[model samples]
Target chain A: MISVLNAGNWAEQYSTIGERAFLSITMTVVGIVIVVFVLTLLTVVVSLMSRLINGKPGGKETTAPKRQPEAAAEKAAVEPAGSSAEPGASASERASETDGALIAVITAAVSLALSDSSQPSAGFKIRRIRRV
Target chain B: MNSIVDFFNAFSETINRLWQGSGFTNIQLSQIGMILIAFVLLYLAIVKKFEPLLLLPIAFGMILTNMPMAGIINMNFYDPDFITSLGYPENTIFAYREVLNEGGLLDYIYLGIKLGIYPPLIFLGIGALTDFGPLLANPRSLLLGAAAQIGIFVAFIGALLLGFTPWEAASIGIIGGADGPTAIFVTKTLAPHLLGAVAVAAYAYMALVPVIQPPIMRALTTKKERGVVMEQLRPVSSTEKIIFPIAVTILVALIIPDALTLVGMLMLGNLLRESKVCERLVKTAGNELLNIVTIFLGVSVGATATASSFLTSRTLLIIGLGVIAFGFGTAAGVLLGKLMYRLSGGKVNPLIGSAGVSAVPMAARVSQKVGSDENPSNFLLMHAMGPNVAGVIGSAVAAGILLALLR
Candidate 1:
């Protein structure tokens, strides 16, 4: 058996098949375990930092809590000005009403601007308002 | 008449010398085979577009070095007479002067690689291009990146079992990191002799990430796990982005100073990009500077692959071990992802775990592809990017550990 404590020429010391195989296996296990430990430490650090800053643990639901208020405000704005419908009207109906009103206002504005310019406003229609 | 005869004799002698100088007469079967290998690399780079930026220059350099009497690289640094005549001790760390006196342009350019300048600079560029937002948003992915490094150690042991010396095995093992620059950097420092085969194996396997990773990812993960939709990452403040590199650098320097060269440069580049004040420097590092270093790094590394050095049983073993290491790394990562998947109550997609191999966007893309195949709405790209970028840091740290222990 080769002395593991020997600091001799590694090639010479670990020349035998048994020595080579044993050292390789030992090193492989040690290397992997160390890597995993280091990374796990990093994981804990990163997870802690993220939690501290974001005030949450993991995944997408964390963002939802932060965005809920903004979404509520948007929902209120998109609601009809004076509908007698219940507070829990289907979301799609409310969305359509908001869209129709938005389109009417946009069309009126465009028609007025085009009428002033004397360009043909007769055939014009706003099909979409892309947010580019 | 005597003058004419004298001129004819001189002309004949000149013609004979030129014939001898021609590469055709000096070319042997091995060198011819190397040239063919060079051509194949060129075809892969140009036609297949497999990491063309690096492979193209590498292939061209191979051709340049193989030509007879080009003297682009001197492989005779080990010759006892050559070492003795140069008045240097035998087996000096590197025969720099021998290369300067007898070597050609490529040999001079090769100094960047030998002295360890180019890889860090390339890392700087990589840092500039990388977005750590994904990593920062999901820090747990760091574990996946760490898990991927299992490939390196596995390969290291495999190389040892195959009769490679400790240093050589360590260098070969680093190929499992799936990081070209890190692999090159470690190989050059640990086993300069194995640089060519190791570098080729590293980059070629890196290019094959798309081919190599999917099967392993599938075998290790289930359809349901692949379809797991990770939540959108929380927004990271600009301050966190700026602090990340500084904190990482400080931590790495304190922990493993040997890795400071690679880790420091990578963090510096990241800091430049995140700071937003150094836009000019960031642009240069990411674009012009990176391009210049890559050309030199590729060609010089390729020039080292002469027929005698590259065509060896050890090279073959390194190549085989490299694949195994990569496979093992992918498996390890996915397995870890499975653990996370189970622990997270099916919230984490195991496919993103495969991104731990640090092949960057390539590994991340594989995760996205596999996930999308399972469920079209499942966008694992951003989640995968988290682990993918972490793998870079993980591999750099691993390289440092190996250097500290082995060197």
Candidate 2:
């Protein structure tokens, strides 16, 4: 393990390092701080991206089909507790014509919403049909 | 009658000769002292449940190697012929390494500690289990993590004052990191002779964190301060989780390449965990594999703490400095937390800052527990976890820094 490089170079190496110690230490400290700062900045950006991709989607609803007026009247028919039962036939007959017209418009709007995305269109469809 | 008398005389003479020739005819006091120490460690592990996972095996190894005539870890390196003739009985031979690799029995045990392999692998297991969500939610906790590194440097200066070489001082200072793997890694690179002492000190303090940290926690903060409830952590998205380790790795590598092995492996483990695809590898790394390595690692480390090497004044100094380092580190973290609390308008609980000691989840859980005692609804676990995990990274980086500087 003989060294061909002379004693002069060894002294030179020592002298060069002595002059550069301050610079080297300062650079190291500054470099570490910058690196830490950058890493953290990157972490924040990535965190935001992941949250956006994985967050719950909002402001959407589903719509169900509307019932016909006669069907609606029939559907709400309350049976008496007694052994005998009635369909409330007189009431159904009274409202059938007007109710059927309203029901037809509601059905069109409800089906239109349902045909679109099943999410959150019901509220809009209901409002439109009620105005009609 | 004359023949019987002569035979009895001859038997007595033979017994006297045998007694004179044997080496251990009288027990030495130093051997007695070592046995007592071994018994104490054993009792502590078994009865008191003090780091029983490591202490028990270590205690057992100490007892075995300490026995006077056992040659359990003893070696005769002076004689080449004796080394050459070593092998198992001809009837049975295991697939062990060649004599050079195998060395002597004690030499083999010493390898586990010397190579610095086992502890970092343990860290990999720890990294796999650690969740960095809290860190992602509140990135400011990184400051507390950085603050805790003050203890390491403080101890380093103290070691230098005590006439230790720069490398030895660096190894001693890493005990303040309160990270066993970091301590082991640094010492392995910097001061191999002091490995046993430094490792023992780090683990001992870690086990004592419950006892050691509370007084410091209470001393540093007011009751009102401890009681403060932190704001809820915003949800950390999966994309952020994936990028966190990658970003840390690149930034850390560019700044201090020496840290890459520890930091790289650690973040890689975390990446595997958060990526959510490598469930099988994660399971193995975290549980079965970790346990197996820990046992071997603990025993091998204990075996290295032989009486001849360990019973020195330097060991005492190392232990003392280790305690000081851990205490100072806890203080720095807590003080930083207090500063953050004031800066955040009391939104942050200062107690969570103590988690920056790099004891991982235990220190974090303690912060949460202590906080909840003051305010039942207060939740600091999530907040504490950020610094806790960050401290692990910071300490590893610090260890790497010391390694590079001292080397």
Candidate 3:
């Protein structure tokens, strides 16, 4: 195929169609490689910065687990005894703490069920005790 | 009888002046064609609302320039060989001198574009408005951005096969970058003649991002892939944000010196926004300064589309190639995104890959929209933004490489 446009009118760098084609391919390959390399370097830069500032890869984990406020509140309510139990605590002590937490949670749920949303402070009502 | 004869002569003289001085005598078929094209652009801008900020001004400037004998813009003054053809040594100042002495209103406004001032200033505004947190939180998105630039080089090769010189090919290829300013900047530097066609193609394609990108995104990814809910991006610290601009600027300076003007301005704006100390400057850069540059840039670029220059077979080729380049770019980004998805074990949503073409929040929004279509609960906007911002840097880098090599 013939060239559609002339090379630089003054310079006439590529007079032949074959040379233009070859140069075109070469230039394209070079451009893609460099673009990818530079951007990849930036990727590394951002990742390094994230690790340096937040002490993790990509800073995916923040300093606090404040992602879900409601979930955190629920966990706090359910794991009151577990929070106090250390790794060094005895198994019997841990079991007793767990039992105490379980009773408190059940009591709280009963109170909430008996209360009205407008009157949230209405205390627990022990109308009946039926073990299922 | 003598007084009546004098009155009739005066009336005849006045009619001759009006007929000769009006545009009607000077208008050519070519100018009429360009005016019609401008009207079409106006319809698209006003009614269809396709990048109205850019299209409206460009269409108006096109009308102004295409008006026969408007004398506002003289293309010969901007032609590279025009000065030399006039038996004078060619220099930019010399050209400006000619315009200053004999040029019109637009000839002065075009100075901003010819001197390559407007694009970098526009980049600064974009930097100020941008939030790099999405990109910073997910560094891998940078790869998708880089991958999207493959479209540029691919289009370069395609343009070469179509018989354009290397410089012309490079200018055309940048349309794939889908960055309007970068395309204009490269065209002005490498192939000023094609500036009109290339700018129109780039801006038109960018505005059509939503239309051009979705089908490709759907064809490449399965419903399951599109439906994948990406993990939330980690919070980027203010410190990281501050460091990012500095790091990118330094990197561009060290690696591609030609890119310094654009990348440097971009980083400076980002730094101003991130530092929070320069709130006053950031507000101005992001809003006032940007708006000013946009008007100048769009109008002057549009004015470059004179009848002879724009009504060429080459312009048609450029428009066709521009869309092809965009498709290639979108595909490359999506493919890389799919690669990341497989590597990350289904954690990464491949749809965000389409945003790597750098239409900014629009491309990101497209990712979100497509993903939402597949899974209503999935919101991919933030995730897509990571690649979207990276695409900005990637395109600038690609432009730098092209200018350095081609020039």
Candidate 4:
């Protein structure tokens, strides 16, 4: 009979289909979120721990002008003693320069707390300081 | 001669029958009115550039449905005894006749809008385009995002008091989040009847964020507070950048189980983007896939706007309440921004907090503009993005809460 073929009469079957679709979508979404969250947490914890244990100190604030003293000190340490040492007032100047240098590095490290890391200019490289 | 005359008479009778069924009827005044209304919507979307890609198709669908005698979207195909039997049952003692189910173009659109499929896929595109660097640099911005979701709950309660059933109220409240996808998802599940009104309101307010947010922002903060310049952000490591979307997915899932699908799809897209491994998938999802879905979603949703069903007092109430919800949401974000501004000793720009409304780059851009107005050199785009992305997550979470509570 035509009545037997009427799909409208199969309300319960259609309802079950709709319900199953909803359940499938919901489960897939939840599963993905959980997986992504756990992995992200692991990465954050691991990176922070590794950085704390092995990362270098004072990674920022090494301006070109500020690094001159460190370079001069390294130059003095490497130079030969017989090479016309015009080391007169330069010795006191270098000593005072070392004191100033120590103060600058300390100040730079402390200021890191106030600076926003969103800006690339906020951080300084120690390698640049050593090169100068 | 008699036979020929009989054939001509029969032909005339057939013509009369067709004429009776083919043209406009007196009862089609409402359909005409709806078509005119749809024209106005189309004009607003096209000329004003107010979500044109979506509104245009929806308006066209509305027009199509309102056309008299057009069976473009007929719902009844299997009715027997077509001339006498009605498509649906009619409850009446005297007539005891079947009621014509009046299959209209709107029925097809109803299918897509009612299923709750389109908006979340849009979220997937949003996730792909979103970068979590700013949020990672300032993890605390997540709190601002969470705070912005106050609009959803508040509106939910308000809608309930307005006499909508729990499901209806929850669907109505999501409009405050100013997220079209979230609005669609919630409405499809809750009050499928109000889906069109809710969808329109959500997208309308999203496009109008710049106009709506400014007055509230100016009223809430002092000139000095607005002028405050936030410090530049630290460079977020690639590792931390990759970890952030994942962490958020976990934390959100653990807190609210229902929000997973919306949030999960969004974060999965984000993860694909951040991981640097699935560039092709990311690009396709963000652009091609998203665009195709938008077209389908828009046309289908528009089809739901049948003249009889959509032209009701309840639709007007949803539109009115939708504005209130968005205003409250914007205010909540600004207030939280102000709190953070105080806590961080004026180092934080409260302007960025307003980005927590889940309107994405628009809300975030508004924050940047407001900040620049205060101090021409103050750049808050990157900072605003943190809370802006957070707002997206927060709205999804709030939507989940509504689903659990209302459904």
Candidate 5:
């Protein structure tokens, strides 16, 4: 084990070199082990924390209420006058509301154009559009 | 005619006095060489944009310190004999009184580094900016961070073989951590004499991460492994993020109290950022406070590299060892990544392993670049961030262990 640890014969080169080489090898092995151990412990701790906080293991979807796409589309159709100055509404909420209304308007225009062309617009569904 | 002659004599005398005290006459070849090195650093910072924020100030400080008899810095503070003659024991806390009484502007600036206040404050800024979500999502990435630290010990042995004292070797070894603040913090405590060389080497190598990591990363991992795609990270809750820093601080403090100053300040900064109530403080810590400390830290650290201390063969060896340490660290992280890849049934991309050297976003970007080369659609940036941030914590832990053993 000693020879393996000092494989490069670093200890043999100098009298003072032996102690430091030994210490370095020991520290290296021990340091790597400790880091791994601590981090592993942290991993387990964090996993537990997430599980406890979210009430489920990793990757479980949250149970918070979300507005469905259909509901959003209906709201957009009914509220053609557009968003009002709602209290405590975030910028993202306002933007998303505006986006739903714009999408509804565009879909209506596309549908009207297709009906006027007198061609069947089968399997034509607008899923989403994102800026590049 | 006599009055005119007297005026001429006085003029000549004044010119002679100016020449005697001027940098032109007092400068040596060594000082000139240091000044030229400083200019090169300035060019690298300005033109190439190599870690410009810190390097620019450092290069400027080097220029200020090397000018002969400028009285910008007191080199005597670094002199051991001089420190002892001032009625204090060797290696005691820095005598700020000595610097306050006899030193100049640079000396006052250097006190931040000498008193070991700058690195932790820098860590505070880093903590505010850092996102631990990726790391939290994939806890196993922490092991890769640990594996990356093999380079530090590899260099420690190399330095020992090359005849650096244990303390000096520890300081040199930390350059492998690829963390400028950690390297500066450890070197300041262990070997202040080598602080200038170590700091420059750490930051320079960090800037060269894109150049240094790719070859080693490619050499260590197979193409198939690099092409592997990782699953997207799960969203982390704000509560988890807030608890993380506190838990880590408490654990590290209990385990290694010596690391408390660096680790504690880092966690505190992170806590402030994660808590969501201290936006003003977080903004200040992350921007204004950080900028101020970085300027003082860089210039003062650069000023320490006077001609007498910097122009030596040892500096060359340190620079060489620093590269070796960084390369070895990259290799080790990749190799461990490969191991984990096999263990996890190819879920992990080995390319992200190279990000374990604590160069933060740079190492992570290199991982992304390498992965994209193999497959253009492969987005490893967010995935690689897990190990990259973990490497920061790992290096701090390693530094604490070294300080505990060696100090």
Candidate 6:
């Protein structure tokens, strides 16, 4: 409804009902055509953007990063107070999972300590971490 | 004794002037009627809780404008007749000092509406607030958005058959899009006279989306179709989110330049929100700036409901046509949904298509509610949101088309 120009000559066209009806029907068709055409084109554009950004609808980003944190967290949460569930699992595997757990704990404590700041991670530094 | 009689006569004359000048005497039956209508709207907004954010200011502005001889709203200033009376050519520019000296406050405020500023700004806020993720997840929902716009044309034909000019008919037809800003934007430019009637009708029906949409939705689709559960949308990437507004703005602007203002500002706001770098600007645009514009917009727009303009048969016809527009828009969306249901081998729920009318979360919520009633497990809100957001673009595009052809 943002009219680009003032209503100059456009007002008061087609005085007769028959003429107006014809104009309306014509405008209706034009309106539908342009609207559908524009949005359908937009749909294509958005779809193209999606493919470019994500590579595929649910590609590597969807499958990889989402599961790693949860799997690591579950292992860390479940293994600490009891026997490790998987006898076939390597010691390095347990150590790797525990490293993620240690990172989460340190980050949490730093986040809490700097909670007064708008960005809690701004001041603190992890410096370095390596397996002992 | 003659001096005493003279004093009494002078006093009587003074009393006569006071009586003539006071609103108590100047109040016309039509003004009273408009005031009563304003009161009824207030009741609806307060008691019925129908879009009070805009309605409250609008109804108050209505009362303020209708007060006899208050001159709070000199709508005459906008009339061609009044412009001519001011000793300038009807379309002359640079009447600034004259208008500032002669016009009422509401007349000045109405400039924002007349020049098409507020609605697009409101759209900027809407864009900042809207998430196009649902829409991008399912691009085909755009068709439902496009299909729903058939109602605008249907209503246009209805208005034309009823004897409205093409310009006025186009203004009324946008009510079918179920987007208030777009409706006001069109009506202000094309048929500024009908702004009040059209705005009232548009907002009233928007608030009643839950009531009006469900019946049309239920009637159009079967129990099984309504019960169909849509799949969860894919996880949209941040990059996709950031790119969407930019892409839409470019495409829509290139094709429909008339749509650029409303659509451009909308996409800019969305871009700001999605970019995540302009939080302060987004907050102001979406929250504080939007609130200020809404107040000004509702008040000035309400003041346009002057007795002479609003109390006409044409106004009533516009209102009647508005509901019809809403109904047609909803039914068209659902009918298309049913068709999609068939085409997609029943994987699609027809209920979500009704959200294509752009009532935003309201239509989407109705879809969810109706679907849940049919089957407790179905969650159509996200799926419905795809079409719901697309309807915003669809309706804006429709308004642009109407403006392009008619204006």
lDDT winner = 3
lDDT of 5 by residue, A1-132 (tens): 333333245445435756666777877787777777777777777778888897766433222123345555566667643374333334777877787887788888888898888688745766675656
Report the alpha-carbon TM-score of model 5 versus the true structure: 0.84
How much RMSD separates candidate 3 from the native structure? 6.5
Where is model 3 more than 4 Å wrong at Cα? Answer: A1-17, A59-132, B91-94
- Computed on C-alphas against the true complex, the DockQ of each candidate is 0.31, 0.05, 0.35, 0.03, 0.23, 0.27
Tens-digit lDDT track for model 5 on B1-407?
Answer: 99999999999999999999898899999999999999999999999999998899889989999999888998777666677888888665555677778788998888888888999999999999898888887777788888899899899889977988767888999999999999999998888889889989999999999999999888888888988977767778899899999999998888877778888888889999999999999999999999999999999999988988899999999999999999999999999999988988998899899999998899999999999999999999988998999899989988998887767
Would you list the C-alpha lDDT of every candidate in the order shown? 0.85, 0.72, 0.87, 0.70, 0.86, 0.86
Model 6 lDDT per residue over B1-407, tens place:
99999999999999999999999999999999999999999999999999898888889889999998778767776776666777876564324555588777887887888888999999999999999988888888999999999889999999988977777888999999999999999998788889999999999899999999999999999999999977667778788888888888888888888888899999999999999999999999999999999999999989989899999999889989999998999999999899989988998999998999999889999999999999998889998999999899999999988877766
In candidate 1 chain B, what residue range of length 10 has the lowest lDDT sum? B75-84
Model 4 lDDT per residue over B1-407, tens place: 99999999999999888877775543387888888888888998989988787888778877776676776664222223342354334421111132225544444444444455667778888899988767756666666776666666566656655655556766887898778888888887766667667887888888888998988888888888888866665566666656656766776688667788899889888888888899999999899989987887776666667776689888888887888888888888899889977977887778888888888889999988887888898888988998888778777877876665445
Judged by DockQ cut-offs, is candidate 5 incorrect, acceptable, medium or high? Answer: acceptable
* Ten-residue stretch with the least lDDT total in model 3 chain B: B87-96
In the predicted model 2, the residue pairs found to clash are A60-A120, A61-A119, A61-A120, A62-A120
> How would you encode candidate 1's per-residue C-alpha lDDT over B61-156 as one tens digit per residue?
888888887777775653346667778886565576777677678768888987899999999999999999888878788899999999999898
Pairs that clash in candidate 6: none
Ranking by DockQ: 3, 1, 6, 5, 2, 4
Give the alpha carbon lDDT tens digit for every residue of A23-101 in model 6: 6777777778888788778777777777777666421123234566678667867686435544345576787678878
For model 2, residues B1-407, the per-residue Cα lDDT tens digits are 99999999999899887776543664356666666777887888889887788777777766666666555554333122443466544422221344245455655655555556776788778878888888777777777777777778778767766756556877898998888878888886777667667877887888888888888988999998999976666666677788778878887788778888788888888898999999998998899878887777776666656676577899999999998888888998899899988988887789988898888777898898888888898878888998898889888888777665555
The estimated TM-scores of all candidates read 0.87, 0.70, 0.87, 0.70, 0.84, 0.83
TM-score of chain B of 4: 0.87
Residue A68 of model 4: what lDDT?
60
Candidate 1: fraction of native contacts reproduced = 0.52
